[model samples]
Target: MSQRKMLQLSAGVLLFLLPWFGGLVSGELSYNFSQCLDFFYKETPPKGFHAAGYQSICQRYKNQYRFASLYHRQHRAPLYSAYRLSPTDGKRPRTSWMYEPQLVFSHASPEMEPFHIPVDQNVIDSQAVLLDYKNSNYTKGHLNPSMHQGTEEDREATFTLTNIIPQRAGSNSGPWNRLENEVLRKFKAFCNGSMYVITGAMPYTSGARWINNRVSVPEYIWSAYCCPSYSTSLPKSVKSFFPSYAAVGRNDRDSGEEIVPVNVRMKASMRGYDVRRMSVETLEGILKQRLAVTISLFQGECQ
Candidate 1:
């Protein structure tokens, strides 16, 4: 063969192989939640939250601990993410959203590096590449919200999509945000010890719903906290919140009002997404009914 012809052929072959080789190097083949329990408190993670084919994720960022999540592959979103609430830190870390590398890359061994992987050319095609919440009506709502963290790094770790779900603007900015703040206040004022929290979603009963066919849109968002110890002298207003409390917030306006009743008197913007706080048992009852499984958020019901 002529030298020029050989060079051209070699170039063409390199071009053809780039995409495949790049994918392999990027760790696209091995993205499941096999090591999700590492983030759980005492390594004793919650039970009965896993559905058939569920994936667990221990959210890490730059080797900094963040939170843990249980992902539903079929729904293409997180069922829940658990984290211990750290005392409030005033500094908010700059938003640099990331994805879980272990979810997409086989070479990206669990706990080998920071849990959050940067977006690059290699992982552009993986299913673990989550949808960007740009130009969309829905917000990229966090299950482990940043407000509950104590340090800038811990707050920033909550930005990863593995710890987020598609939530309504009303719920994310209004009642749900209020609920998170309230919980933070209680944790700071009353709890003298670590407070374990698990926040998750409840999909529609009949079928799954997706946002832009890329992410699951939950029917409702629920959260529960277990504080084994707290101030003995509690204010009457928040007396019932100590030890444990749970709440379920509506995500859709058209859904029935059985689990979370909508208040007709509230303004239109906040009317449909009311968050109803209840005891841990009540939340479990609702979860059992919706998820069709025995749901236990805390061991011994936080004792």
Candidate 2:
């Protein structure tokens, strides 16, 4: 081969390999919430919901970003996942669980998918994997549900362990599910503008609860939404839900009813862990009392 031709081919190969080499050198690139400031309303996340040991993670999956979360390292779970609801989403994406590479190692920038890359100890703790759910009564519950996203990619980004919490099957598949559907229906029928949603879990009052000593189990799972614009004429049944709404689902059926009152009429299987819908202020009140922090989930209370 001519020397000139060899030089040109070598240059082309170098250009093609640069990106891969850069990724290898930098490790993986994971993002923080500040990296995607546009996703939040006015570039402002929730306030007064901080904890001592929690770390903030901005979830990026398959190059499609979705939301941000406050992850509790010791608990091996998320305190909450915040996302803006997409109105055009039609179907859920077929995807697997992913993890934040930076959580376990500082060298990585982007997130990692276990199927695409070998599972590494520096990614997530061994107890945080999907295998932990096996033979367990609890389910891997999502704080930021995929159904709220606008596209398949955005939906798929929600399936990360940092966005999951240990939830009882009764709450995960029953009352909690109903609350999600109700929120979806309201968002579809009433909301006319961007909707900001934040879902999180509350730890037990006395001490930390654990699943196999790996993941922390929450005492209650709570969710709230703020829609700045919406239909003026709402149905009487849902009239109170406009602008903002919140609900708390019980993780333990045996727990007291000071916050979320269980429905006595529900069947045996779905009776406990009932979800009670309330006003945004009311939800915040409960959260403030339980979390011991004055949480402001929306800007100016979505006024």
Candidate 3:
């Protein structure tokens, strides 16, 4: 059947009656990241901020665990996504965007499903929907980008809205995108084994921005990796990046320079959205100060 025809199907055929899981309360969604533990370093997730309004999701696609995301129920955005870095294999998948049904219905399908017309009201109220981004200034930025994954299925799995946030075009395609490529280069050159990565969004301290009054726009885009196993034969310049290194990019032009500075001299499209590269420890310090929480992104700082 054609795409248009499939979407034209009666709502009766699509609407589902989900079973309520007992013992689960309202404004509460917490599941152990048990299913997707392999994506994290040492099979351990980022520590420090697991309070109310935050839910854990094991991003399952095609009945296989791909990555994990810490989604914020109130913000309708993800706090971060943890995944194992994979080499790119083919063209980007033109798959339709998806949402996490488990956020709305406890016993719904574990996999991410594409949005259909007349979207379920509960799903929209629970999480971000396609309409939230329609004609909006912000872009549906993936915390776990497709280029970072190796297999086709792995790439497709990154399209879920649970793994995305509202990002500006300058930061998403410019400096931040460059930072991702840089990490890929370092991974292909120095890493001998696995490389685990955790990428997250850092919200503003005050005057938080929202898209369509639905999704929260992040102030800074931060990412870190832990590749404990690597080739000992490394260059002096690139030695500091081993095991663990981190970076934070400016998502707003007028944001403070404390976390990331704005480059006023660059072209209009790329200026003001600069990316600051630093050691994992430095990144953690900034995270602590800004978030007002003592958080560790890697195990023992990837020692």
Candidate with maximal lDDT: 3
> For model 3, how does the per-residue alpha-carbon lDDT over 247-287 read when each residue is reduced to its tens digit?
99888898778777777887899898899999989998888
TM per candidate: 0.81, 0.84, 0.89
**Whole-model Cα lDDT of every candidate shown, in order:** 0.70, 0.72, 0.80
Of 1 and 3, the candidate ranking higher by TM-score = 3
Could you tell me the lDDT of residue 83 within candidate 1?
A: 88
lDDT of 2: 0.72
**Which regions of candidate 1 are displaced past 4 Å?**
1-42, 49-52, 109-125, 128-132
Best by TM-score: 3
For residues 4-112, what per-residue lDDT tens digits would candidate 2 score against the true structure? 3443233111101001011211222222354554555555666563223345566777665568876656567877888888764567667777877776665665664
Residue 174, candidate 2: C-alpha displacement in angstroms: 0.7
Across 29-110, the per-residue lDDT of candidate 1 in tens digits comes to 1122223433443345554532234455667666655677766444456778888899865666777667666555556754
